[model samples]
Target chain A: DAGITQSPRHKVTETGTPVTLRCHQTENHRYMYWYRQDPGHGLRLIHYSYGVKDTDKGEVSDGYSVSRSKTEDFLLTLESATSSQTSVYFCAISSGVWQAKPNTFGSGTRLTVV
Target chain B: EDQVTQSPEALRLQEGESSSLNCSYTVSGLRGLFWYRQDPGKGPEFLFTLYSAGEEKEKERLKATITKKESFLHITAPKPEDSATYLCAVLASGSRLTFGEGTQLTVNP
Candidate 1:
């Protein structure tokens, strides 16, 4: 919802395989973020992009990378998926400076690494 | 480091039961505090934003209040449809939003 879309709603991959999740936004928001939801950990930010080509790591950046080649798209890549990385991933967009404004999140992509 | 901690990992209530969820936070240069609701498979939906201590906002049966150290989400006269996980997050001096382990709320009719 909120003009944000994440592809491949569900996926199961072998451990150590590379995986990429895509986030697309029609809202033209200037900020986009990738986060993972796990039991007990809550939502942990993986990466965020302030603008196209301007991406930065977040709290839980290990084993994760993100890229934004266009304003509407942000991609998160797990170089080598692990069972520990299996969780629901959410994409968020913020339309404010430094993102003080509330973020709009996508429906989430459930990724399972076997 | 900016951090947020929500209490009562899970809650269950009968229809029309009133309750509150707590989110205690510690952050330098507090920017804002936000509340969100998430269903089983969906992304979190924004509920309210509190910019400063003592500020409060309300929507439907939910009222969110904030202070310097913590925030409270009060649910009044809850219905079965109100069941969902409520998340609290805070934005401080940096660009990242730190979130707390949400409180899963179940409203039984």
Candidate 2:
């Protein structure tokens, strides 16, 4: 298993409320990514960070924001959560380019917005 | 836009049965193809990485092979422990990976 951890393994919240998920890695990988998994949708990347404070948007970045202040921590924030945002969120890390090296993933966070 | 598609959303196999899962993809510049296995309530675990067409990789009873447009994950003499969702993804030149919906495999003892 990879040294990756996602906090609040399971969470339930009301719609229109602020929600934040945390991903911490001990591997000191250079790349970290936040993705959401839904039924029939597979895994969709919301955001990614190549280095400290260097981030980029993924295909499903709308209504979500991420920040990576240090090498080990990457945070994903949903300013105002919606029912549509309810999904299983996963965090992945890679020591080198993802295409060259397989990404190690954290257990995951199951969030529900009602 | 790069896309990945997996067929037969779910599969059922008896223990010792051999089978394969398919992943078809289209990417601008192919960099690599990846296979991951996920048990219920757990994140995906990396399985294999195929770089070019005709490339093959193996681990235990699992084998992954790739071609120009698709990849296949073959399992031999599967066991109950092999039950899981198998995910396929393609990493293009930009380091972004596009994933398939996955094939849920159930091996019964």
- Best by DockQ, which number? 1
Estimate the TM-score for candidate 2.
0.96
Cα lDDT over the full model 2: 0.91
Give the per-residue lDDT digits (tens) of candidate 2, residues B1-109: 8999997799999999999999999998898889999999999999998999999999999999999999999999999999999999988886578899999999999
DockQ of each: 0.75, 0.71
| TM-score of chain B, candidates 1 onward in order | 0.97, 0.97
Instruction: Evaluate residue A89 in candidate 1 and report its C-alpha lDDT on the 0 to 100 scale.
Output: 97
**Looking at model 2 chain A, which ten-residue stretch has the lowest summed lDDT?**
A95-104
Q: RMSD in Å for candidate 1, one decimal?
A: 1.3
lDDT of 1 by residue, A9-112 (tens): 99999999999999999999999999899998879888889999999888899999999999999999999999999999999999987666446899999999
What RMSD does each model have against the real structure? 1.3, 1.4
Candidate 1 at A84: error in angstroms?
A: 1.7
Candidate 1 chain A worst ten-residue window by lDDT: A95-104
Off by over 4 Å in 2: A98-102
Chain A TM-score of each candidate structure, as shown: 0.96, 0.95
